[model samples]
Target: MLKKVISKTIQLPDNRVITIETGKLATQANGSVLIRMGNTMLLAAVVAKEAPEEGGFSFLPLSVDYQEKFAASGKIPGGFLKREGRLGDHEVLIARLVDRAIRPLFPKRFNSEIQINISLISADETILPDALAALAASSALSVSSIPFNGPISEVRVARVNGTFLINPSPSLLEQADINLIVAASDSSILMVEGAMSEVGEADMIAAIRYAHDAIKLQCQVQKELMEAVGVEKTIGTTHHASAIVCYPIALREAIYADLYAVAKQHIPSKALRKEAFMAVSNRYREQLAKDQNGQEVTTTQQKEWLDELENQAIRALILNENVRLDGRLLDQIRPIESEIDYLPSAHGSALFTRGETQSLTTVTLGSKFDEQIIDRAMEDGYNRFMLHYNFPGFSTGEVKPNRGPSRREIGHGNLAMRALKAVLPPDKENLYTIRVVSDILESNGSSSMATVCAGSLALMDAGILVKAAVSGIAMGMITDPTTGRFAVLSDILGDEDRIGDMDFKVTGTYQGITACQMDMKVAGISYAMLEKALHQAKEGRLHILEKMAETIAAPRLDSKPHAPKIVTIEVEKEMIGAIIGPGGKVIQEIQKETFTNIDIAEQGYKGIVTIFAGNQEMLEKAVSRIKTITARPVMGEIYKGKVKSVLNYGAFVEFMPGKDGFLHVSEVRLERIENLEDVLEVGEELQVKLIGIEPKTGKYRLSRKVLLAPDVVAAGG
Candidate 1:
């Protein structure tokens, strides 16, 4: 039965429209939505494949992809390898963004394989595919049978001339000093990624609120779509809440009372608080063990009893005493120490330590060929500037195998990458490939933000003419005791992050924000709180930037001596074969002799050669060889030559660039010579003069004997 459904589409100022169609598409899935804004469109379908089998779900497998086809972009794939085959970094990142926004809304027991594919049928530069993908996924989940506790919306916010511009175009974004992407549910924010100058916390929060306000209509449109086409609600099976074990309430109260008093008198260190909590837990355990009723308890029962006691102690400490594990004011930021130019070999390097969290970021510059290439189903190939975050087990005081990057690492890296992407120089202006690697030396909370701060300083130190200097700060909020009142902290510690309601990270330059990200542990935050957090974060970010600038004010104008030297050469299509030789023999000989790395484009007209030697001497040698191989002879040029073969009338002399010219005896010299060998031998070097050119053929007529003396020529004859 085809049901006619009403769809709503709201047009925004930035040439973007939010559309929701109800009665059409993917009725069987938990939720589905087809979103179209401008020429950019995506059909996002959300379906949960399966529920958790045995253990509780620890991870959410959410996939988000932005597929770009040649047809959509009005261009075909440009290589001999025609079809798009693999997912690029951008696709992986967009997938991560949607996953982060939606994963938090699912119940822990609903650990199912949830897949959301954002298929791009058309593309418009203004309406960002990423933000559209988020809306589509949210709408699909809201209408689907899959249990999603969301109808979220996202927006791209930019600051141009100190004014917040929502969903700015690509060109407008280029002109704007700050670009921030924010995704929020009705009440709380879910995701943020963008870059700015060193912007204040107050402004950062304002930007978030602005984005929330801007996208409210889109969220409503999604809701209307669900009302129109959403499937019938499936009754979700609820799990029974765990039973709370009985313990001595009086004894637990007394222990917590004493511990609270001690904590109040002396701000206990993290280790001290942990030890004191453990001692109280052990005492309660002993009391249970010595119960005189002869009641034997199982291990599980004992653990439950201990867990209850621990929860009580923690809850009492927070609710009654209003004190944290590590004593600090509710809004107080952690101490920070930032230093740049720490690595001698790297182009730029910085070490940023905020409280216990520390990130060592390094930047590397390379040729255009070094840019990342991404290929996936929906999108063809594209290049990217990348950021990679690494978290070793030692960063958290644990011992684990040293392996490749985890999904968390990828997620963190992508977040930082997105934040900085707005400020990265365009490909045409800066041809150098950029790679920023953030290594977490220690982590407490928001190490990803620490990575951003360090990365910015490293970029500046490396002398990359970035649009602006960027710094990031992590903001945390602790709600008030009675009301939902909260205090936003600048730099949060590990415990604060665990207990806090929000982990908001803002990165940008002094002029404004470049990137911002926010995640919540509780329900969404109010606009006022977000404002306060941003205001406070700005102050903290500026302080960190000041410290960073003291070490390295700007990126060094020159690259490191150890860095690779790249030289690009353009050769004619016909001459490419000659330089490459048959089966690449000629190119191989050049590499072996010069010890350089040479990469030739598949098109055969352009080549990029990288020399990693200690000095320019090796680079010059390699360039000279390439020039010789690809060089062509110019008309009306003189050269020193050697005669290879002689005829009665003329002698064949090697002259010009990679060519041989014929010297006739009549024009060999002023006086005629009896034999060609009399004046020039097979193994002799002689100065040759070009006198005439053959128009039909490219061969040149040279006179070697013309410059010889008459007496010398006659004597030789």
Candidate 2:
């Protein structure tokens, strides 16, 4: 046995070098690669099994898994088990990044089950592993003998101070106005996901082009690595993986006329149009069998050809006829309707329906306890805002068992969150935690965009002072590579999405874009085409926003009367423990007596306190109590207190939260008393004034006569 190691290095714009090597650890896998940048290291391995099992699925079964080891960041796993648990949100999101980049590159009919596993072996917080994971997975596929037309790579471009930096550090990301992730092959851009602080479209395209150059270089490196390793992707040919996939051209031609007519019919119901197309196809198949014309083709081949014809017909109609399946023009958007306060008990709710898609969205405002705490290797914090999306089978007119939210739901929810997050007020202005949930009631296309529309209305209805309203549009593209013509379709339908080359979802306000995602099923689109799509999307978004304004123009002036009010106050940080008291005695008494909720945070020099109550009366009462707890008695100031103890010549009176002042027998009352206990009992209340204080002893001298008449005090009455 012999072990050989070879590595390839690429230089980044910042003069930093990254290296990827094969023949390292996990060499026994089909293909293995370890990528390193600075102290961060990731190992990716891929294995494919041809025709492993027949589960009656036509598409490739690709399983991508990304895992992070706590030890990689020099920390032990959290929780009682002290081991890695289920897949985290970041892991799922990153796995999707890798899957989207490589899934489309597999040979058209290659249906093998491929598993790509990427693990974080070593890492530093500075170098992000998410972008590298995609490169490693693609590099492994490239060097393996698996049949793929890819050597794709993904990069994260972050704009800081108007300059785009590739894969910026954690601290740098904080300063970035735009954080964009791009996955691409040498010649094409495959996937894109990004969030911006209201960045413009031109700037976004420039960042993409910048990322395009870096992706091309990485793809070249992968090709060189594959050449050096002498690995050729002939798995499909060797295993007969796609050997039987042939669409009969004659059958396609026979069905083209009817399919084109059906595509142009503009049927309002998607199901009806789909059924009509199927019926026509069945009739044609019977005619062909009777004539013994296409009987030689297998049923699979016939079905495949029919589907191709449908896709081709739809594309041709859009490109040549300048019409969509729904009969709208290229730049036209579907009809939209929106309503708010649809749910009585919800903090806020809205229903937004566009064409056939509908979303029922609700907003819930919570407290600090509701914020989500994330614990991961490199990223650990609390997220104050969260958005959840759900889609059921019935939404699309199907009868399937409901399991749970799929990865698509999470990804869609994340996009909506990004779109709405930009409009949220600063944390200080809005202290309540916000959660937005969008449930799809009907689905024809772009339910995620519908969610965005509904979420904005829900936020406003909930009395959240968002900076601006946000809307979204899903744009589709029909490209004719040979003819050099393309049509950018706005508000695309599900059918168009299935056959179209691009699914570009843009979300924002009228001024600029907040978040966007574009996944390409075809080769790279030029910047000009992207610009056209963006402008079209903007137009569609504005149209949708105009419709939304009719329902609710802005956030309500006040939250629901039932909603609790939160009043925040700051006290000296050193007084926090005392306010809490020993064993939580003092604060508990105040809460029980005042019937209010209190939350505290220890800031630098002060303790931030928030009081939650049902009404203004309770809120003011709680505030007064807290002020008493933090208030200090000043010399020559009058105070009303309770006598906690009686001494031989003096009494100890409790004034502030825990402060006590000594009242001498001479200052016990306006008249002279023989004994202190005779005039002052242990449980009596009195009004006193601080006369003097011993600085060193920190003791107070109080006189009750100050609050009484001066003549009465002189006469000893």
Candidate 3:
């Protein structure tokens, strides 16, 4: 017998319907929901394998998979390797988004092995899979017995020409100056990702509000689905609320005042700030310990009090004095200094520093064959241009083992890549493979934005014809409605990002936006605020661009000497066998002789060979060898030949055709010769001319001498 389930569906204004089917699939799982919007559909299933072990709540192992099958888009897998194998960048990012949104929803002790799978059955391209995946995962966990707090919803808010567009189409997104994906749990924001030309705090807040309101209907559907078929939620773990202890408010106020006074005396450095705070915390702890009441305080309680004091001091410093810990104004951006051509051997290189954050971005150009081939469960394609961000431990004054690129690096690189994608030349006849590597030498806040600035300069230094120079800025916001106050900060600092409500990063060209990412710690923002932020961001971005242009106006026309030289050749189908010989022998010989890298297409008609050397001379030598091996010999050509044999009337001359031709004694020289050996010798090269062909005899007639003076002939005789 089939189990009956409750499901709800709502039609969006864009003619797309979102459906939440519950208790229909994956019944054993904690929560399951299948969401279908337009032609795109996703089935999200959440299951908690086990609860946390004793005293082991270090981290959450939440595995999320956003899989895409070739069949979903009516396409077959390409390449000799016929299967999708790895998780693509897109898949990893979607998984990260879902994990970030749902991980915080669970209680602290609920360390369950949460596994959420989002399978894309169809893809319409207009509906982004990442936001939908986050929504489905949140709803699925809510209706499950996995002890989740409740349902959550996500929406993509884009601003185009000062208008807020919720869940805009992919094409419309191309024109948007700011794009933000916000995930909320009704009252508070859980996750946010955005990019802009250089949006300010106000516009970013507006986008958050637009997305929050736009997702209301979807949230309602999730609630209805839970009512219809959700399993009974498990009771949350019980814990006692911390008891409030009275400390003299005047004493607390005095302690904060003294702390700020001491903070002002110290220089603004991360170490300085840490030491100052530690000293104040210790002084307060000592004072509390000596109280006559002898009220005992746990270390945890003392630490919490210290944290609250620190937060208050920092907030007060920013709000009342309008001065950051670093002594910068509320809206003053950090100092930026950029330089291009920093590396001698790089095709393009730039060093970008904003405040203490620094990044060295380098660009490399190669042939189309150098493009990265992606084989993933979600998507399969080739990317000619790639951006890689590297953050070493030393960049943050930390000690950690070095390994391959981390998830954070990948995500940041992808964000930069997306922001610059709009300005890249189309992948048509221009088939150069471009790769950019951004190394974060120092980081305080918004290193990714520094990467963007440095990357644009590096591309120009490498001679890339970008549409326009691009720059990025991180905007921060602090809003206290109780005081009827709000402050929008430009180029936020690390502490500002930590205590502030939002980290809105906007990157774009001078013409418009190219990429944007926004994340908020508070509830959400309004549309009006987002618009203002975008406008401010554009101004900030343009200022940064001006500074960058002073160092390098455009990409360099010449590449680095160390880079390889690519030479392409097209041969006939039949000649491919000759080039390859037996088991690639001929090609291997060419590689060995020329010291060149040869990449042959599987189709055998086209080949791209890369020659790497110190200069063009070596490259030319390699090209010459390949041309000779593949050259077609021509008939009736005058060539230097060696005399192989001598006859009574003529001599046989061996030419490059691997055949011998006759040189008549009468035509051997202008003067008559008694023997062929007198005028010519074996193993000697002699100039021979093709006279005519004796068709009846099928022999070639060649001559060394056609006419001579009679007197010279008589003298020789």
- What is each predicted model's overall lDDT from 0 to 1? 0.69, 0.86, 0.73
Candidate 3 stretches greater than 4 Å from native = 10-18, 36-41, 47-88, 100-128, 145-152, 155-214, 230-234, 237-246, 259-267, 288-295, 364-370, 426-432, 481-484, 567-590, 600-615, 623-717
Model 2 TM-score, all chains together: 0.94
lDDT, model 1: 0.69
Model 3 TM-score? 0.76
Give all TM-scores, in the order shown.
0.77, 0.94, 0.76
Instruction: Put down candidate 1 lDDT per residue, 1-717, tens digits, no spaces.
Output: 975655788778655556766546666656666777767767777666655445423345556665656566776665697866565556666776776677778764455667777777777766667767777788777777777777787778888888788777777777776577788887677777666555555666677778888777777777776766645656353331223334456765676565555445434345565677567656666665533345555455565545544544444455455555566554555677888778898877889887778999999877655677754434445465889999999988889897777667887887788667767777645656789999999988789988887888888777676776667778877665466545666677665676566788877677766667677765467777777777777787777778667767766776666765655666666666766778988778877887676666535455444333334677788778777767766655557888888888888888743467888888777776788667667867777877777888978888755556677467762
Q: State the weakest 10-residue window (summed lDDT) of model 1.
A: 237-246
| C-alpha lDDT of candidate 3 relative to the true structure | 0.73
Q: Choose 1 or 3, whichever is better by TM-score.
A: 1
Clashes of each: 40, 0, 27
Predicted structure with the largest TM-score when compared to the true one: 2
Per-residue error for 5 in candidate 1, Å, reads 5.8
The CA-based lDDT of model 2 is what? 0.86
**In candidate 2, which residue ranges exceed 4 Å CA deviation?**
52-56, 237-254, 288-302, 614-617, 710-717
lDDT of 3 by residue, 1-717 (tens): 796776788666566677777767777777787787877878888876554445333356568887787777777767776766666677788777777666656765455567888888778767766668887887787688777765778878888889988778878988887777788876666667766654555666677777777677777777777777646866344321112544677777878887677545534577677788888877777676533356776665566566667776777677777777788776667778998889988888999999889999998877655778875434457888889999999998999798887778888898888777667767643446889999999988889999999999998887777877888898887777687466677787777787787777888776666676766555555454556566667777888888888988766665666765555566555555666768988777766776666665534455544444334566687667666555543445666778898877889986543346788899887777887767676777887767766769757677767424476447661
